[model samples]
Target: MMPNTYTQIYIQLVFATKGRDSQITNLVREEIEKYICGIFNNKGQKVMAIYANPDHVHIFFSYKNLQITISDLVKVVKTESTNFINEKKLCVNHFTWQQGYGAFSYAKSQKERVVNYILNQETHHEKKSFRDEYVEFLNAFEIEFKDEYLFEFYD
Candidate 1:
């Protein structure tokens, strides 16, 4: 018998830089996005879309199999991006991502909608802060949250 072939899995991930400094500039953002895509490609993952805002990032990707955990993926993105930014001296303060990230699973049917939302993060964030946006994602996903851990994000 042959091993079971896993189905493609789509994930939406959101995370912000440490201290909410809005330090990612246009050129740096583009370079980081390109580097992220390269990382995903090497890992046998497909980055369908990506948008790196001033303070945070949004990514849509598909995995061929459940070989990697979401936490690991987040760590890779964070570490690589930080290293790249530091190497280039892109920002004044050292670039670092917050400790936590938010990832939500979506069906193939919902891909377009999620991509649109991510693409418009600049406009969406104009009316709300990243803290509020993070909470909204948690609430919408029906994930329980402790006020303690959540408040740390704002601080």
Candidate 2:
């Protein structure tokens, strides 16, 4: 009998800088994405796509670790990445993530679509503001949320 269990969970995590400040500039965006990827990989998560926008970031990963909950993993990434940015002085100001994040799950069938969406964040944001896009995701997932509880929208 096989002792291993089988499971596949795709998660897309969206988070913005504290106060939705545009601290992640083009110069450090790629480095931040790579660092975040390393954080996910260290936890044995398979990263599908990661993008760092001026004010926010989108991370798509496959979760298989039964030991760590999604919330815990996000917390680790956010905290660690914040420390990394500050330690490395990647930004002009101290770096910090907002209080909360958005975690959306997807079916295996939607993997490619989700990855494409995350990879195209730059182009997508050009047409739509992050606030609108985030609200759309909440509406699509039928998640009831109040504006006050949402990220401090600076846009």
Candidate 3:
């Protein structure tokens, strides 16, 4: 039997900063998303969707060879976005991503549904806070999560 050929995989990653002040405005958020996309594109990764709120970000990406680990990809996105924001003088204080991130795998058929959910974050947040939303994702994925580690953006 021949070895199985590599297959492309899609992942949805969610991460936020330590504080709510990280995302000051839409301009800053747009820059961060653009920079992340640019970085991944340069490395031959394809970004399927992206959405940013005042505190966190959701990114969906697909890779052919699976060359990048989730940690490596998160690090690059955070580091590059931070540098780009700083270099452009976009924000006053230093920006940083939280210590951990939430990543979930999805079937190819679910791509559109996932992307739509991400794209409508702004509207969705009107009824649900980021914390609640995050919890929902965790629950939907059936992953165990400690409440203490989950950051609350809205009071």
By TM-score, the best candidate is: 2
The C-alpha lDDT values of all candidates are 0.82, 0.93, 0.81
Q: By lDDT, who's the top model here?
A: 2
Runs in model 2 lying further than 4 Å from the true structure: none
Candidate 1 accuracy as TM-score: 0.89
Q: Candidate 2 or 3, higher lDDT?
A: 2
Model 1 Cα lDDT, one tens digit per residue, 18-71? 876788888677888898888888777888889898888889988764687778
Clashing pairs in 1: none
Error of 3 at 111 (Å): 0.7
Clashes of each: 0, 0, 0
RMSD of each: 1.9, 1.0, 2.3
Worst 10 residues of 3 by lDDT: 16-25
TM agreement with the true structure for every prediction: 0.89, 0.97, 0.88
Better of 1 and 3 by lDDT: 1
TM-score of 3: 0.88
- List model 2 lDDT by residue over 1-155, tens digit each: 87997889999999999988899999999999999999888998999999999899999999988789989998999999999999999999988999899999999999999999999989999899999999999999999999999999977
